[model samples]
Structure formats: C-alpha cells, structure tokens
Target: MTPFRLGVLVNPLAGLGGSVALKGSDDVAEQALALGAEPKAQQRMLQALSLCRPHFNNIEFKTASGSMGADLLEQLGVTAQVLHQLEPEAVTTADDTTAAAAALLDSGVDLLLFAGGDGTARDICSLLEARGRSDRQVVLGVPAGVKIHSGVYGITPKASGEVVALMAQGELVSSMMAEVRDIDEVAFRQGQVRAKHYGEMRIPEALKFVQAVKMGGQEIKELVLDDICAEFIERMDSDCQYIMGSGSTVAAVMAELGFDNTLLGVDLIDCDGVIASDLTASQLLEQIDHRPTKLVVTLIGGQGHLFGRGNQQLSPQLLRHLGADNIIILATKSKLEALEGRPMISDTGDPELDVALAGWYPIITGYHDEVLYPLQ
Candidate 1:
C-alpha cells in the first residue's frame, strides 16, 4: 500500500516570548531566551507526532534539518528525508521557515504540517501566494506561539494530530481556505492590538479540531445590540467579577456600561468600572481569586466558537474555576443562523473541559430574547 506523504516543519523559537510576557516571539527571541524562557515549539510538535505513532507505517515523513523539523522526528525514532538543510550552529529565522516550506512544496507532499504561531503561518502562506499555489497546497498549523490569530491552526496539538491521523487512515477529510492573521508585536506589547490579514491557506476542514478565522469589526445590527446590552446590564451583579472577552459584541456590552474595552484582548470589569485592561492569561488567573466571576463572551461569527478562537487568555484552568453556568454568551440571531445548524464549539485545549461545557444554553440575542443554543 502507498503511504501518505506528510511534510513537517517546526519553528524552534516560535513561542519563547509568551512565557516571559513579551506578547509575541517575532524578533525578540533572544530577549525572551535571556529571560529564561525555554523553547516549546519542538515539544508541541512532539505532542502531535506522538499521536501519529500508531499509523507510522502508513505515513512517509519529509522535513527540514535540525530543530526546524528533523530533530524532533529523530527524537521520536521516526526517520524522515531531510529536504532542506540549515547552516550548522546557525539560528533559525523566518527566511529558514520560508525556504524549508519551498523545499517541501517542491517535494509534492499531500499535506504540510507546520508547528508555530501566526508568524510562521504567514511565512508558509506567503510562499504559497508568491508561487500562486495557495489553492493547491494543503497546510495545517500546530499552535505553539503566543500570537495565534490565524485560522489555519488546529485547536490544540493533539487535535492537529488527530486530523493528520484521519488522512493517514484514508478518511475523506475535505479542505477549506483559512485566513492567516498576525498582530504587530510592538503594539501588542504596548497593550494595543493591530491584527492584519496576510493571506489564506488551504487546510483540512475538521471543525471539531480546527478553529475558524476570527471575525473582525463591529456587528451591523445596532438596535439589536442595544437590546442585548440592556438585558445583560440589567442582570449584571455589582458584587461579581466579570471577565469581558474579546470581540465587538462583547465590546458593545462594555460600551453600554461606560467602561473602556480591549477590542481584541480580555478585560476585567465590575459594576465599579474597568478593574484592569488587556490582561495576560496569568494576570487573569491571578485576579479571579475565587471571586464570584462570570465570563462575558461572544461567538466567533460564521464559526460559532464560544471559546479558543481569540480568547486564549481564558485558559482552561480559569474556565474550570468559573464553571460553565457562569458563562454569558451574546450573539446576534443572524450569526447563529449562519451556522446552518452546526453546534457551537469549545476547543479550549482541554478535552475534558470541552465536554463539560457542552449542552444547551440560553444565548442573549435581544431584550428579553434568547434562543437555546447547543455548545459542543
């Protein structure tokens, strides 16, 4: 039997800055390392590849040399043909990522599995665009970076592996074009978010594993927002801590309460006012303090994801603490209808929590208006 051609690439320095609170690992990899940050891209790659062990004989691996790809495969006792070689003792860079992607494309792999953040996704997507092969090449991203606004990535490392495993088993997984987006690291560090679209790449459409491109901008329904906000504000308890999630729908609620909103990041608020703006995952967990906290979130339009799109700050630990009943979901009726009956997804990177979060819940659509929506 012919084996599935699997191309693998890893950005060795992808998420180094995330642990040390640098916001992103674009050009500040050295500074991140200076802060005692350890490399995690290869470890994340290991998580994905480990799950593919059972189907090893049915898959042919191709990758770049060293930490870029071959090193991790070697560690797993899997042999891969090194199509691109990096200079010995040289630090990996974005150029290396692109060059390695070019080599993989030239080798004609069925799917290219890349482990990195949005920046890495942009490198590979840009190369495909430059070669006019965006439609032809199928790529998948394993989330190992601080900034993961792109839609090409799997919800988690294990989820990405599961998708590849399906292909290895000869399952008919369809492909779809997912957007590639990145935020300016400088602005992000300064507490301002400026996400811009780079391009799109074709990825396996396994909705249970892959996330959707974040819907940007404000909702068009002005009066419906007013009604929704009115209903939410009426129910807001002054004693409870509210974790305001990212997105315009949630921003509308903040605006109604006369509090400053982080349009693309998490914010902490209460009846008193904005407690903190633009918090990291650790900062958010610190502030909860076992207080009666509720999370105000909106689904990613067209995708119907309640968690794990742009709100990674709501880490699984925090979600479990807040409990599922404390979550307040806000979305327009049109947005829910657009899903065409697909259930809302919660790819929180914790399979157990995702299952716990599933069930029917009332979604605030307008004043005294709600529809029972299923979150899976």
Candidate 2:
C-alpha cells in the first residue's frame, strides 16, 4: 500500500489555561505561563506520535519546525519533513499556526493532525477554506485544548493516533463535515459560555474515537425542566447529600427547590437547601467527605458528553469517590434524540475511571419517565 502523507502541528500553548482555571488559553498564554502553567499540547502530541510509531514506515510526516510539531516527532525517533520555520521564542501566536497549516496544505498532505482547542481548529479551518482545500484533505484534532466544542477533535490524544493509523493503513473509515466552534475568552473567563460556529471541516470519522460537536441549549422547554425538577424532588433522600453538576438542566432542578443555583458552576445541595455554590474540585471533595453523597448531572445536547467538557470541577477523583451508581443523569427527550442514538462520552483523563463510568445508565427524561442510555 502507498504511504499516506500526514501533516503534524501543535499549538504549543494550547490548554495552558485549564489547570489555572482560565477557561481557555486563546489570548492568555502569557498569564497561564506566569501562573506556572506547563505546555500540554506537545506532551499530548507525543502521546499520539508514540501510539503511531509502529506504523511509521507507512506514513510520511510533514511537520512545522521547533516546538510546534517536528520536535515532538523527532523525540519519538520519526523523521518528518519540516515545512514552516518558526522563530525560536518563548511563545507562538495564531499567525504561526496559520502559516504552519498553509505550508502543510501546500505540501500535499492527505491528513492534517493538529493539537489544540477550538481556536487552533478555527485557524486551520480558515486556512482550509481560504485555500479551498477543505474538501480534498482530511483533518483530525488531538484534544489538548481547554474549550474544544469542535466535532473535528478526537476524544483523546491516543484516540487521535489510532484514527490516523487506521487511515494510514487505508482502512475503510468514513468522513464527514464537523463544526468548528469557538468561544469568547473574556466571557468564558467570567463563567459565561458564549460559543459560536466559526466554520466546518471535513474530518475522518472513527466512531469510538472522534467526538461530537457540542449543541446549544437554545431549545429548552420550561415545562420539561419543571417536570424534571418535581420528579427529582419527589425522589430526594434527606439523609443523602446531593451534589448538583453544572449546566442549565441541573440548574433547573435547583430552581424547583426555591434555591439560588450557580448556572455554570458546581453546587452542593441537600433536602434543606443549597449547602455550597460555585465550589472547586478540592472544595467538592471536602464537602462530601466520608458522607453518603450523590451527584446530579445532565448531558451536553449534541456532544452527549457526561463529564470533562464544561464541568471539569467534577474531577475524576471525585467521580471515583461518588461511584457511578450514586449519580443521577437528567435530560430532555429532545436533547437525547439530538444524539441520534449515539452513546454519551466522558474524557475525564482517567482511562480506568472512564471505563468504569461506561455502560448503560438510567437517564431521567421527565416526571416518572426514564431511559437507559449508554455512557461511553
């Protein structure tokens, strides 16, 4: 079989803002660096390169120079044709990303493997559209950014590698147009999520590896939320501490109990009222220490993600402590149908925890109604 030319690019500073609670690293890379944040995109790209190293002979890698892409591939002992020459600096900008993408496109690569979040995706998407190469070339994203609402990204770095391997072997993988969504960093930092579709790209589809585009909660019904709220109240156990997950759907449940809720942050509640609002990961663990606690959450509409998207406050450690059985999932029928029979996903960065959280879980649809949905 003929070797497939793969273009590799890393944003270098992608996901630098997540650990420091910066929401996104779009224009705040310097702040994240000042806060002692480390570069994760290169490490994640290394993970992908490591997984695909065995098939190196079947793939010809085309990458940017320095910390952008070729450096990581070189560490893995894979020789790649360096396309763009980036200046040696402590930081790289959006221009570097666009230039690398343009050079990769000009090199006639079959697939472009990128490491970053929505902003990086937007940069590449714009380059593809401007060059009119979106239809001819396939793109895949390694999930290394903070705000990744794009459907072009794989669920994880390892998943991205596996999909690339499949394509390199000329496997019968499908392709489709996925949305590239980005949010305002300023608004996102203030805990207000304002995501917009920047563009779309044709990406290789791997059912278990690629992620779905996040859906907006614009089609919400007040009555359905009211019914779900009433249902949850009826089943509340006064003795068990209930931790409310983030999202408008979970916020609705809190509204029914006549308590002020954190619309986009984690809150802990009980039969009495709200115990804590806008708690952190450490605070969540402290509040639920050695006590019988349950978590209430809802799925992202089109994405079908149960965790690791907007609510990173629900740490993997916390999820392991709470266990899957003690968790309650709420979603409207319209939201569930939006998935078109796709299982919900979780990328908590813990493979063991992700596996444990997998399988079918009962999702409360409305008053006295439930459906078994697979959590993958």
Candidate 3:
C-alpha cells in the first residue's frame, strides 16, 4: 500500500470569533475581540498539526505562506517545503486558500487536510471544481468554527484525530457528502437567521458527522418521542422535581401528562411532564424544592446538538442535578444522519460549559436501542 502524500492547509483566521462570549463574533475585527474571539486561529491550527505529525515521518507537507498553513506547520516541527506564501507571520485569506489548494493538487498529494469550518470548506470546494480534481483529492476537517455545517468534519478534535489516523492506514473508507452551509452574518446580526447551502463534497465519513433526518407523520412524529417521554415521566419514581426543556418532542410528554408546555421555551416539569415552572435558570432552581431532577432533551436535525445550541436553561447547576446519566437524548432514525457524523452541537452561551459536555454519550434514538454519539 502507498503511504499517503497528504497536503495540509490551515486557516489561521478560522473561529477567530464566535458566540462563545456573552456576544458572538461581530462582523468587524473590533467586535471579535470584544467577544473573546482573539486571533486563536494560530493556536487551533498548531493543535491540528500536532495531531497530524505522528502519522507521516518523511511526507512532503505543502502549505501557503503565513499563518494560513505554513507557520502552523512550522511550529509543529513539520519541516516541509513552503508553497506559494510570501510571509510566515501574516494571515491567509480565502483567495490564498483556493490558490494554495490548487497548487497542492498539481504537485500530486494523496489527500488535502484542511482545518476550518464550513466557510473554509467552501473555498476548498471551489478550488477542486476549478481544477476538475474533486475525485482525486481527499479531504478532512478540523473543527474550529462557530457554525460548521459540513459532514467532512469529525464530531470533535479527538474523533477527528482518530479519523485521520485511520485514513493514513489506507483503509477502505467512503467519502461522505460534505455540504456547504453559511449563516448570513449580516442578517443574523440584525436578528435575522439566514443559512444558505453553497455546495457539497464527498469526504470520508469516518471523520465528520452526518445531519439527523427530520421525523415525519404529524401523528407518529408527535407520538414516538412523546410516548417514550411520557412513560419515562411517569417513572420519575421520586419527588425529585423535574425540569422540562422545551421542544415539540418534550411537548409530547406534557401533552400526555395533561399540561400545556411552551413548545420553544424551557419548562420545569414534574416527574410526569407537568409544568411546575416554565421559568429561567434562577427561577428553575427556585421552584425545585426537591433533589435529583432529570433533564430530557432530543438531538437537533441536521446539526445533532442536544443542549448548548437550543436550550439555554440546562445550566451547569441544572446538569449537576440532572447528572450525565440523567441527561436523556432522543432522536429518530430519519434524523440520525442529517449531517452524517457531526454530533449535535450545543452553544449554551458558555464555552467551558459546552466543552464540559464533550466526549461520547449514549443516545436513545429508538426504543431500548442506543447509539454512542459524540456531544462535543
């Protein structure tokens, strides 16, 4: 078997800003730093390179000039020849990214490993299509973005590392369809949520996540999650007050329990989905005069995130009470591969809180059957 000739490209500007802070990344640079999105692209890029180093000892590592991909590799001790870069300390733009990717293809690399989110994916896709070399080039993603809606990325850094190692081994892997999705930052800043699909690529599924399929049937879609949740609610078995996180799935349980639940808001429920307090985090703790409450949640379709992104009320205190074991994840087969391997992401306003829920956890996508999905 031929050991792979891999091309490494790092977008040092990626995830430079995000919604981790009280405020998300601003359209301008001044706004990015205010929200704690410093120029950590270099840091994240180095991390990905550090992970790549162990696999190839004498491989040719091609990168653009500057922090785009060159400096990051240099810092990680990758003594490969530089590509078409002019500076090592500067940052690379999307223009530089596409050009360098095309250069790497002409030089004959086995796979092109890129570090960034969906935006970076779009650039790579453009280059591949321009060169008519999409099929010849293999790609992988290192997750370091705010909204990465691509199946080319692994669920987490660790999972991504694992996928790359397997690829280096020359195993029979399949190229998953990596789609291009970008949120309209301008509109989003103006409180309008707009996401557009740019394109698709077939990368190795062993690396990234698939979007969950959307459940159907007004009757059945409404019934499965609700019925399952209702049975679990009835079995709460203790006065351990409950917190009802919002969603139509959770609403099903409330429907069975004869309680009117807010479909989009977090609700505090009894062990039986009875809304005791549809309050905020502070209000939730106030209403719970008991111990050991459980948090019921379901995976999001197309993203697979359970807590951090949608429900903001499952705070650290709430998780401590619900416990990891008590955190229930529900999804249907239809929505399991929405983005392929990208685990459901949670952006619950805290980066530390978000990473705390990292690692793989058991998800009940069906009755009595569970799949271990990454939650980082």
- Candidate 2, residues 284-367, lDDT tens digits: the string is 999888578999999888998899998999999899998776889998766776776666788898988887676445567667
Ranking by TM-score, best first?
1, 2, 3
lDDT of 1 by residue, 1-376 (tens): 3367889999999999999999889999899999999999999989988888999997889999999999999999998999999999787899999999999978867789999999999999889999887855688999999989999999999999998887676443555678999999898989999999999987875533221222434444777788889989998997898999999999999999899999999999999899999999999999999578999999999988889999999999999988766888898776776876677789999998987776545577777655555677
Give the residue spans of candidate 2 off by over 4 A: 207-376
lDDT of 3 by residue, 264-359 (tens): 777776654555556777777666555656677776677666876667767777665555556766565456555465555766667776655554
Candidate lDDT values, in order = 0.85, 0.83, 0.62
- What's the TM-score of each model vs. the native? 0.56, 0.55, 0.50
Show the colliding residue pairs in model 1.
none
Which candidate ranks first by TM-score, i.e. highest?
A: 1
Question: How far does residue 373 in candidate 1 sit from its true spot (Å)?
Answer: 34
Q: Which candidate is the best by lDDT?
A: 1
Q: What residue runs in model 3 are displaced by over 4 Å at the alpha carbon?
A: 19-36, 88-91, 207-376
Model 1's C-alpha root-mean-square deviation from the true structure amounts to 19.8
Cα displacement (Å) at residue 50, model 3? 3.4
lDDT of 1: 0.85
